[model samples]
Target: MRNVAICGSHVKNFISSPSFVTAIEMDGVPIFCGLIHTEDIKFDRHIPENRFKVLVRKIAFSYNYRDKNLIFTTAIKAALNRFYVVGSEFVGEVIDIGSDVTDFQIGDKVIGNNHYPNSGIEGVPGGLPSNNSSTEYQVFHQIKLIKVPPQIPDEVAATISIGGQTTYSMLRKLSLTEGSNVLVTSANSNTSLFAINALNKHKVNIYATTTSMRFEKELKEMGVKRLIQIEPNSENWVADELAEEIVKEKGSFDCIIDPFFDIHIGKLIPLLASGGRYITCGFYDQYSSLIGKEFQYRGLTTSEIFVTMMLKNIQIIGNCIGKTEDLQNAIQDYASGSLNVVIDSVFSGKQVGEFFERTYNAKDRFGKVVYRYD
Candidate 1:
């Protein structure tokens, strides 16, 4: 059996292991000898499918920052038992089916997502793929997999599972309409980008926040009227210039889609309209170095923040991955060309670490960063 694993130390090694990936040369194959352990991996031809394997040849898989951080978490280290598969999104075709399986046939393309339990977004506990998409082959339950329309390419279809669903769910939560004044943080993120593009026809007045000007031209093309640039290290995320511009132009945002809730949330409360909505699909500040910091409140420390939130008559909604039906509808949108999934780059097999690293250093990519398998 063949599979790819994102290696990390066992909880037992957490005390002594100084590093995660300690590669040692052996027979020209690097074996992780420290916190992580990598061994020779080979695939099987008797790919027995108890009725569920995506594609005969996995076409592609995209990178999500959560996948990398998940494997590094102390909880994940212990919960995953020994090792962790590194991807939550998978795109491929049905090459095999188990004896009683009747939902699929050979060559039917499909997309699947990893289940996030206990997430703020609240979705059915439909099981996730048994392993991450970093492997050449993965066997997931039939219920979690959604068949993709033939028109959607493998790369674009790959995103419908996670990014698309998350965006769709957040958009619907915002209840956006024509002339809705909205603000989206991390405008270059795949989730944020998809959400913005999906709102194109709604005639919404879009304001975006980012630290980079690299995507300024593109985001403006996407209809973002004003952009707020915030540094990760800056305490004043909503700079004075942006605040003045907002006061001069739009009084308050009717909706704010934020992922950096840990850092910039203090600035958002004052910007929300009387009955505006503040929804977060994720919090990046909480994703600290797993081996470095303990899991605690990395975002908001003051109860006053919540008090202000409530006093403003604002709604604070927490989101994770979307519902199963949301995933299906996202695929339909991608298939019908009602949505677009932008991919930054593609990698090939055996580049697991490379894939994670590229996504980690994504300062210039506008959309998704993906990898393919032959």
Candidate 2:
């Protein structure tokens, strides 16, 4: 079975989790001569205060488990058990079927989600191995599969399971209203572009931000109401010289969606009108804590849209996505052509590591970079 595992060796360099190590300690020793005791202790290379942050990390993982059907690991020693079958979302010629299978047969084209094969839960896995579809012949229960729609392409459909789901979850959290105003940072990103197109049907006004003017024509074609050209040194918290011009025309966004976390969260608050929403799913950089007093003084609220913290009445929400449903919604939108899927370039799968590095660094390019497997 040739399944792709995000091997721990590669994961350590990119992962945020500190390595888990073994150590011994003495607790409340009352003159016990020659007594040695051992207990597991945490040593986070990322921070000095590991325990306090551990609670936050655990809470975040628990939230992801509920929302996205997978876990995000920060532990260097934790095994890389998270994965999905490559062909699950695309229609494939079934090579085999279990004796108990009822809904499917060999040579049938199918589309479905990847799940923990044994436990039968959507994202929760029983103590079973995850590699399934990567094999020459793989088998799964009929109940776990969904029929693939004939209309979508395999490359576009491939991302629906992850990208679409995530975009939907974030949008839902934003609770956009009819005629709402939106500011999408990194407007050329796969999710960002989808979001703009998602709200295009509504009477909402969209202000798309990009680092280059090259996207102006493309974004305009996608029906973006406005485009804000951002320089490499653009600051979100401090008012730019162009801030007045933007606010004057668009009246500031009712909700702000950022995917790359390129826009500083602290700086993003001021870009919103009073009681406007600010939501994001990915933060590529470490963030400074939100200044509540600054928000209070400005009569604005702040939030991080994880599943755990529910923000009501404030209008701003932070959302993270990891689920099959979210993926499906995104996929459906794309298939219908309402959402535009723009790829900057597609590289061979072997170059995926460098692809991500380029994505993370944003060296020189525009649009989403997809890695295709032959």
Candidate 3:
């Protein structure tokens, strides 16, 4: 099976033999990907009597920021000899099923469940279904996959799991009331897009921040009440005209949803209302290459942050992926036409480099970048 993988400097120590190697470059860095032959798994011989497992053939996949960090860091890991297959969100077909599997059929369409915090099953660790989803074939427990409804297109299904799950999970934590003033940072992000769409149903007053107004119309259409455009080079949010505008109009935010806490925490915490809630799922400076590079806090110290939170009775919440029900609810919303996934673009065949560039480096990208296998 041909899979997209990160072949480190010592790849030969990991992959004993690959059928062929294909080199692709992104941001001037070489990514080694290739086709490899593997012995077919005999389901009958491998299936456990008590556990249900399914063999899936990947159809399409998408990148998350986490996946991007994983790829780049794995490429440069000093002692990492294994070639890591890079992808998290994917849509696939169930090619085979174990005898105990009753929830899926041989031809069912599925996406990873990615239940987190708890998998609800004994001894089953909850998280992504596979870190190596770029592989053409993979085996997963039946509980780790969700059936995709016929109404949701393949591209949307491919990218929906992480963003949808995380958004629903974070919003559930916030538990905002109707008409609550909410701020969403990194507004062009997939999670923010999903949050905006879901927040529309909650009837909240949504204010979003972006570095550019390139997708202002689209964001408004998604029900963002106000779009605050900030200068890319601006360091001081206290003096930023756009930031002041939000403060003038909203007074203070009742809740703040941020994708990167490290980038926005110092700038945003001062804007939260007394007793407000701040929720974050991730940070931008994840990999060593980019760590400490985003200095947006303007010298805001940890002591200051704690002081503000303590005086205001503000709550800071950290969220992981989500419960299985979060994904289920997102899927239900999509099926009922109440929610949608925003896809920036799709790539197929051998457009590997283009996929990575569009996924990671495209300033104009406002949604998920997908790669489909033929």
Candidate 4:
């Protein structure tokens, strides 16, 4: 069987330019990378009872910051590492099922876990996906799978499993209501876009930050009135200049939704209103871009953080993936045409290398970038 997988034990060295494993051929046919190493992976024919093979045909998986951090940020110097398939979500059809499986049939369009909960990033290192989802087929547990509504687009269905759930869970915790003021960073992110869509009905005043004005039109459509644009590389960025600008323009935010957790935390904490919540999913930048280093955002002295927290009476919340309930809600909203999933672009299987490249440098992507299988 052909599979495109991450090399856990082997790291590819890019001399002039970085490289990625985007293609693979099954059996004797050189589908992706030239072959002849069947000994590496013993294709097991013995099927597990609760596990099943899903021919997602086209896999729509998002690259998490944590994964890139390990691979690129520190130049792949993670203290503890292992070999396993890499991906967070999978969208496709179940072509085969186990003996005891009754929830799925031979051809059920579905969505499910690509790996153990939050393992694609920081949930746990050991629980990587059994099948790297970039392949044509995957073996996923029945319990982790959900049936996609006929109304949901394949691309939209593909994007939901991770970003959707995260947004749903975060919004529920923030408890936005009319007259509430909220702040979100990386407004163009899939997670933030979904949160903004959900908050649209709440009539909450939304404040968003973007590095580029290209997303200005998109943010406005999501009901964001005030947009904050900052340069992490700028000398004044870490000086809390953006924080002060936020106060003057929007005063204080009731909730701050931040997935890109880095040195900006110190700047953001002061911008929160009394009893406000600061929520985060991961520190994506520290791992992905080795470019201009931002000032110390995290790792503040205990006294410095404690004083800020006490002064504002702010609550710091760490959120990983959302609960099953969150996925269900997101799915329902998508099916009902209430949720809007902005797909940045679609790439073909032949463009696998370019797909990863686009994701690495997401230029002008307002939503999820989908890779559709033919």
TM-score of each: 0.79, 0.58, 0.90, 0.77
Q: What residue runs in model 4 are displaced by over 4 Å at the alpha carbon?
A: 5-60, 70-85, 113-131, 238-249, 285-301
The TM-score between candidate 2 and the true structure equals 0.58
Candidate 1 structure quality by residue, lDDT tens digits, 137-244:
655556667778889888787666878778777887788888989999888877788877777757899999888887888889878888778765655655787668
| Residue-wise C-alpha lDDT for candidate 4, range 238-349, written one tens digit per residue | 3376566666776788888988777457566777788888888766545323444443544446677668888989898887767667778888887887777877777765
Worst 10 residues of 4 by lDDT: 29-38
Cα deviation in Å at residue 322, candidate 4? 1.2
Off by over 4 Å in 1: 7-57, 71-84, 113-124, 286-301, 349-353
What lDDT does candidate 2 reach at residue 188? 67
lDDT of each: 0.66, 0.47, 0.82, 0.62
Candidate 1 at residue 251, lDDT?
89
- The stretch of ten residues in a row with the least summed lDDT in candidate 1 is 26-35
Residue runs of model 2 more than 4 Å from their true location after superposition: 1-93, 101-123, 126-146, 231-239, 260-263, 286-313, 322-325, 347-364
Q: How many clashing pairs does model 1 include?
A: 5
Query: Cα RMSD (Å) per model?
Result: 6.8, 14.5, 3.1, 7.1
- As a whole number from 0 to 100, the lDDT of residue 171 in candidate 3 is 88
